[model samples]
Target: MSDMTIGKVAQAVGVGVETIRFYERRGLIEQPLRPKSGGYRVYPDETVQRVQFIRRAQHLGFSLREIAELLSLRASHGTDAIEVRQRATAKLQDVDHKIERLRHIRRGLMALLDRCPGQGPLRCCSIIDALEHDQRLASEPAERKEPDMQTVRLTIKGMHCDGCAEIVRHVLEQQPGVKGCSVSHENGEAKVAVDTSQTSGERLAEAVQGAGYSASLVTEAG
Candidate 1:
């Protein structure tokens, strides 16, 4: 490959000229040498391939700094497999976390939609009421007290919004043995007071799943 102009390299990589210049400024890609005759800035053919590499990395969620490190590794002839594998592993973990969070968000939206009548007045809309409050607006006072109440900490998943907390609370409170429930979507936790003799933590988790969410026992008071 011989000398190529910056515009030519950008066109070859399907990127704008400014993008290449920006990468150069970020030290992600090298700037070509200035022409001795002062015609136009020309780059080597290899720069096109490097720009493509950077763009591909960006598409995969690598920050410019990480891409720079990757480029450095690419340039080094003695790059170790372990270093590359570690970066790949870390990226995979990040992607998995993101997928989990999105799944939670989707489930919360579905739960809300399931409660929505979609044809009623805004005041009667269950989804609207859920969003406007942290707890269920229709909760009734406990009719009776339990002789032996247990406190359980549940790790609640599929709670990506404040409304999700409300939904979880509503689900648990509707159960026969449940005294009350408090939930925090941000922390993905629900603390419930229940009649231990009548209901178990697994039952509570099952109820949460019935409400279109996930729950697991973190701790239970005997």
Candidate 2:
């Protein structure tokens, strides 16, 4: 078939006319020039297929930039399947990491819920207290003695503001053996001092992750 009007192309591709225009603006698709008669901008039939391809890629979690690269690879000569596979593999790994993070978040939330007594004074509510104080509901006994003091550095992600840093600092300080912690949102890192007998770097990392962020132990000091 010959070229189609923008409306017809949108109908064929099951997308809105503005969506096509947006794709054009994003350089995902070309915008045909108006004819000398100046009636309407028409799109080639191939645009329908390309739009479909873009939508399919989006459903597979490919960003517009990645889709553009995929389109370029498709149009380029001597492109290897391995190149496409590598991108897919990277995306898969990203999805897996997100899934694991979500699971960790779920566990943290469930633990909080389990500790909360449904009926209690607002100030005494475990959930409310946890949020207000940045501490877990159930913590280690206060009688535990500190023998070995250690300091650990952690690389944190997803902190966007000063409030997030403050929350992270409080969470660390509230941990069983944690004596103190310094969190910097600008640096995306935290240095924590703890009693090694009660908490390790790994445990500190888990505490940070449980507070709705990603954290990894960078270094440990005795």
Candidate 3:
């Protein structure tokens, strides 16, 4: 096929012009050199196929980074199919894990809904009470106890936004024996206080991981 201008490439690929530039910036696609005559840069027909491949991979839940790796594998000579298969298998496992986490969230929401009368005043609403109780527990200090109290610092990954930090905080605070937690998406960390007799640092990390983010105990102190 003949080479086409950037506009034609975008039109043919069903994406905006900026999107093509974005792909170039992300290293997912290469931008052709400008013509010596000072004309627009042309794109080869292969660019269309590559952009389509990226879109299809995204639809299948693969992130841009993963798609780049797939493209690299495709461009490599003598690459085995196993490499591609392994990536797909790993992606499938991630999807399954997210599905399970969503199921848990749905069940918890349903339980709250079942307990709610749906028409009561806000103060007496089961849903409101449940949410308020969590907020209070996360902020309030735990009562004095005989058991030793410990604080653990956790480094987390895969949190992309503020909402992710909130989810991690909720998961941490809901754990048994947890007194409070502070989570920050920017720093990708969580500081949790718990009663050592009821829960351990490892268990807290596992709880965060179960919520779909990677977590590891960084430090623990009594």
lDDT of 3: 0.82
Q: On residues 3-107, what C-alpha lDDT tens digit does candidate 2 reach at each position?
A: 899999988889899999999999999999999888998888899999999999999999999999999999989765545655665566567766766666777
Report the lDDT tens digits of candidate 3 across residue range 1-222: 689987888898799999989999999999999989998898889999999999999999999999999999999996655467556766765787778666667777777878889896788898888887763222222333454456678999999999999999999989987766778899998877666789988999999999999999995342
Better model by lDDT: candidate 1 vs candidate 2: 2
* lDDT by residue (tens digit), candidate 1, 129-207: 8888854433333343324556677998889998888989898988876666678899898877766778888999999
> After superposing candidate 1, which stretches have Cα over 4 Å from the reference?
135-222
lDDT of every model, 2 decimals: 0.79, 0.82, 0.82
Q: Which clashing pairs does model 1 show?
A: none
Residue 195 of model 1, lDDT score: 64
Worst 10 residues of 2 by lDDT: 137-146
Clash statistics: count for each candidate:
0, 0, 0
97 Cα displacement, candidate 3 (Å): 0.3
* Model 2 alpha-carbon miss at residue 84, Å: 0.5
As for TM-score, the candidate ahead, 1 or 2, is 2
TM for candidate 3 is 0.59
lDDT winner between 1 and 3, please give it. Answer: 3
